[model samples]
Target: MAVIGAAVDSETKQVFDAIARSRSVTTSRLAGALITDFIRAEKGGQVVTTKAPGLPAMGHAAAHAGAKTEQVYVRLEPYYYDELGRLAAQRRWYRSAYLANLLYAHVDRLPVLCHDEVNAVRQVARQLADIGRNVNQIARKVNIDPDRADLSAFDFELVRMLLDVETAAVKDLVHANLRTWGATDVQ
Candidate 1:
């Protein structure tokens, strides 16, 4: 290896020896590599930060064999919003957790809402269904003549009255429940 360390001082040799010991490589091979690097820099003006010791033909794998690398991206939203909502819900804790999933969803997994809010929404829906059922039931009870050419003579105010009653009932129920539970009026 052209008398390795022909140009480097004893301190450089000690550094190379330490590097070899720490890296679990032979001193002679590391010294030979340093000499070859100097020769390459002197002759070809090529400066490389890393020097590789000689490898056998069968051991041609990379120094960092079996290493893996990847790239990823992250997205962020407000962190405190959900936590505040959850704490409010826990503070009240009057409504069931399942109803919260029904706020903006039919079955589940559509959107987020506190349990109190979802129960209020569900109560409104139930009141509407009740009004429809009551209208159908009253119509059946009155025995209106369907054979008539025009049943416009019948009182239409009854239907409006039923809807108003339903609306009032839902309002009273929601306001009372919200007061009872002390749910935060976030949504």
Candidate 2:
């Protein structure tokens, strides 16, 4: 390989360095464009801004190798960290691999909920929990002594109606929240 030295401003150097690192564009092409721009400007003409040439076709492995990845740091509680370690061990994977998989599983294809949507969801969840508790209490009463309690079919119907109303309210609120947040297509 032949090397050529040229003086350029720091900003220009940064642009050239970025192009070279991309691996899709050559520094020689970038240098040619810069020189063209300089010639036009020297002639008292407007600076010509042209798009970079297309990249050469690359093999699958070359493309994969050229792709960039970044490292991310996260702080976790000790208990959570230990649990993650245990899960990784159970799966016979590195901690990073297990954690990445867990995150993808939980978040993949999920809609981005805003603060208001999240709060609405939490409220609906609390209401559902309350309804569940009430149903459980009714069940316990019936199961403990069915003969003593005069719980007729009407009582069960009333409970069912209450559940239906709560379920409908929760569904409507969630739908409205998602709509307001501009997430209409989410499942």
Candidate 3:
């Protein structure tokens, strides 16, 4: 970092940096020498420049792909409401809670959640090594009161919802383009 007092004006360099930061486009992320080209073209009223590159591309793709673009700091998911309603049915059910347990277990490596009162099931498949060892067993271990939960009472609707949820989960893994990041909330 030898700052051999250069002939170049430091003030102009700072202005260029500010402009770049405001636009959220770094030369490194850009394909070629776009910044130099842009400055050369800005002599007059050059309304729009090269392709609008930023965060809109990231969030739009994230919403469609069903994945968290970066750190998904959202406070729980919407499906949790549906799951909560399901718990108030003819008889309280733990299907959603079970699926969430599995999903978190697979991704976060946290022990499967065994709580009977919760929304969103784990929806992921079991990966135990024993003959019949399954996610249910893991769920049982984690449940506050497992022996009486009667997980054997399979609920078709819950299974279908979990499958649909898992399908969306897989889509989330697809990363989004950086160009769309900042512009996502504008509309």
**After superposition, candidate 3 runs with Cα above 4 Å error:** 1-7, 27-50, 55-187
Sliding window of 10 residues with minimal summed lDDT for model 2: 54-63
Native RMSD of candidate 2 (Å)? 21.7
In model 3, how large is the Cα lDDT of residue 54? Answer: 52
Per-residue lDDT of 93-114 in model 2, one digit per residue for the tens? 6777665544433322223344
Task: Choose 1 or 2, whichever is better by TM-score.
Answer: 2
Estimate, for each residue in 1-187, the C-alpha lDDT of model 1 and write its tens digit: 2453356788987876656654445677656655666888889867432424332111112222332423233343557546545655664643333233222133211234456657776877887888778668657755766564354765668768867876776666555545434442422
What order do you get sorting by TM-score, best first? 2, 1, 3
Cα lDDT tens digits, model 3, 1-187, are: 2222234488876654544444455524332335444665777544333334351223222323344434333254669756655643423435454444334334322233233211223333321123135445656665967656665665656655666666554333211111122212222
Predictions in order: lDDT: 0.52, 0.60, 0.40
Off by over 4 Å in 2: 1-111, 181-187
- Top TM-score: which candidate number? 2
Stretches off by above 4 angstroms in model 1 are 1-111, 142-155, 161-187
User: Cα RMSD (Å) per model?
Assistant: 28.7, 21.7, 19.2
Task: Pick the lDDT winner.
Answer: 2
Select the stronger candidate by lDDT from 1 and 2: 2
